[model samples]
Target: MQITKPTFYNEFSCIAGSCPDTCCAGWQIMIDQNSLKKYRHCKGAFRNRLLNDIDWKEHSFRQYQKRCAFLNEDNLCDIYSEAGKDMLCDTCRKYPRHIEEFEGLRELSLSLSCPEAARIFLSHKEKIIFRTVEKETPEETYDDFDYFLFTALMDTRDYLFSVIQDRSVPCALRRRKLLACGHDFQLCLDQNELFQWETIRTRHQNSAFGDSFQKKIFKWKDAEKSSDNLRKSIWKTIIPQMEILRSGWHDYLRDTLTPLYTSCDTEQQYQNVCLEFETFYPDWKIQEEQLLLYWIYTYFCGAIYDEQIFAKVKMAVVCTFMIHELAVGTWLLQQKQFSFPDLVSICYRFSRELEHSDQNLNKLEELLDWEEIFSLGNLLEI
Candidate 1:
């Protein structure tokens, strides 16, 4: 078995009760079979409470207004403190950290859903290093797994990350390179010429990816104009969708976005938005880099097992970009004197809307098949 994780693995400990937002709330905690059986035959005074607390038919613990039933006013879990640490289900025991299994490999990443996890992920000072170690003994295996496809996927992911994390190229250029790489890799996979991956690797490293990208930008009949139009259209669609994620989201959207949302006719709106971001996040470039890094890191590694390469990449990019857009919306609201909770509320809500929805995921996957002229760098452009 091979285990892999980012270097920041040791830096996280659930803030638990003190968390500005509790993981115990706002999401379903699925109970595993073993835990369910134990809960069924429990012999303690808490057994009746357990039976009542769990939605046994649904195989999930009941939530109180989106929070777990066991959560106390102090945000602590009553079950664990009273029963023992091991008494909690798998979902309760391990959270914020998600494990994606691929054949003999386990890739670990912290979910951005947790505010504390988000802060830690976005605050990293160095390029994320993925460290892999083989267990002293081989671990369990799936009934049928494709090791060859997994290796090929791993290679392609490494190539994608190299393009994304390359600092010399402008962010837009890096994104374009990645998109191109994904396209070419898909082609190679279709032809079953995995051995020629070396050629793609070479082309990625010593190519004029940025120069060609800039040409593509200028060669378009009306590039900037089209971009402005796209930006307006995208935000118009996204803002409304974000409203469905949680309560008060519409208020946050209206308070933050409505005023500045139309303040500048397309021409100056971009500049105003840039200035707003600079005013709020200070060194926003570093954070943008972190976002790109995280998206590529999490999804790229997972592609090793699931050959749904394009879906994973598209999901990564869309999720990060949506979060960025939402943050901008929050910033726009804050400039109008909204509170931090307003922004945090918007973030959490937007996450739930996009992250939790099967329909939204399918929509994004479909959109990925469409022609794309804008890249992450273009989004970053002031």
Candidate 2:
């Protein structure tokens, strides 16, 4: 068996009580069977507290006013203090460290939903790198796994990462190229010409393709009115459909973003604010690129399971765009000032709302696919 993770994976440590936001709150903490049984047989003084805190029928910790029952006044876990780290359930033990299982491989990633993990990710100066290690274990197989498709997807993802990290290209152009790569790949897949991915990749690398892409981007910029309207319309329609994980998050979006969308009388004014926000934080582009790369690396390869290759990249693009929009709205709210810490807060908050919920993730993908808002041209326009 093999284990893979980002190079910065080991850098993450739970800040516990110091975390600006507690993971113990605003979400369900499911207790694994082994942990549940341990709780039932617990011989310690904390056993009664455990039995009272957990809802055995649901295999989850009961929340006290949207916080875990075990979460103490200091925002620390009482279970960890009383019973030790070994007592934590699978979810609690492995949080932020997400694992995706393949036939003989496990890919681990730190979920940005954790503020500390988000800090490690967004604050990194260098491009993200993935590392893999092999482990001795039992053999495993998936009856319906498509090894060939998976290989192609991995190769394409590597190519995309290289393109995205090629600092010479403007981040916007990198995004355009990434979307173009997805568009071409999807076309080939639809036509059952998956073998031509190499050709598509080769074409994208050519100087001519870059020139043409730049021209289209300029044209996209020229059609600001229509594009802005489309962008706003898409957000207005989709944001409402998302499964609201925390009512506060829904309110945050409504309170912060609603006015931004409505107040901008023209596309130019909106673009100006985005530009000004970027200028306010000189390294904003780098942060944005890092964010895009993180999402792509984390979720793109999962397309091998569902074969929704384009949708995966589309999700990354749309989510990154949304995060940027949130940042812009936040800047407006903070008297045209933005801080890295606040941006990190927004990123993790967005992740917590969307990434933590499988239902929301699936819904976003479904909405993107059904609406086709992330089509090649549309993505470029945005």
Candidate 3:
């Protein structure tokens, strides 16, 4: 079997008690079967605590006021402190390090929902690189696996990453190019013309496609006017439909974004805020590129499982765009000044709310198809 991970995969270390937000809280932690058996057999001073803390009926750790029962006042795991790391469950052991499995492949990525992972990703100025390693494991097979489609998706994703990382191209142009590539690839997939994907990829990588996409972007920019009401409507309509993981998140969005959107009297003022804020943070574009690449690299390949290629790309685009919008709202809250830390906070929080919930992810994907919410033209307008 082969494993693939980002270059920064090994660089993540949990902040533990020092974490601004603890993953142990505000989320359900499922106990794997192995861990459950081990806990049942555990015989020691900590055994009672383990048995008490877990809700075996649900196969999950019990939460005390939305915080993990094991999490103490210091925001550290009491179970870990008592029984050491060996006693931790699989979910606890492999947090932030997410594993997506294929027939014989394991793709590992650090979940942006973790604040430390978010900081590591946003702090890096260089282009991200992926690494692969082979391991001796028994081969597994799946009846539904599509090797050809998977290969094509990987090649297409690699090309998209290259375009995104190209420093000479503006970030907006790179995004347009990626959307164009996905649009074209989706058309072929819709027609069951998977064999033509290579040709489509090659065409997208060519200079002519980039030039044409740039022209389209220019025309869109000329025609598009930023609207605070449009932004408000988008968030208002979409945010409520998402599965609410933490009530605080819903309240946070309401408290922070609602006022910001309402205060902007004109589209020009909103655009000016975004423009001036970018000036304060000159590397905003690079940060955005990193975010886009991260989302694409982590989730895009999973399209092989469901053949939702375009939806995956749209998810990446919409996610990065929403994060940017949240950053803008945050800047307004901070008196027109934005910080890198604030950007990191927004990315991780957004990921925590959206990425952590499968239901929410599906809802967002559904919303993408709804023309009233996020049309392709609106997504491409950026």
Q: Pick the candidate with the highest lDDT.
A: 2
Please estimate how well model 3 matches the true structure, expressed as its whole-model Cα lDDT. 0.82
lDDT of 2 by residue, 1-382 (tens): 9898989899988888788988888778888999999999999779899888899999999997878999989989888998999999999999989988888889898998999999998998888888888999999989889888888888899898888788886787788777778877878888999889888777777743366768866665434337677777667767788777676777898777865777677778888878888888877788888888888988888887777777888887888888988888888888888898988999999999888778888888888777755556677777
Q: Write the per-residue lDDT of candidate 1 for residues 102-128, one digit (tens) a residue.
A: 777788877666777767776665667
Each prediction's whole-model lDDT (CA): 0.65, 0.83, 0.82
Q: Can you rank all candidates by lDDT, best first?
A: 2, 3, 1
Per-residue lDDT tens digits of candidate 3, residues 1-382? 9999989899999889778888987678999999999999999998998888899999999998888999988999987898889889999999999998888899999999999999998899999999889999998999989899888988899998898898886777778777777777878888999999888777666653455757765665424535455566677767888887776787788777764667668877777777887888888889999988988998888888767777778778878878888887788778877888898889888998888788888887777655454655666654
Candidate 3: which stretches are off by over 4 Å? 208-210, 215-229
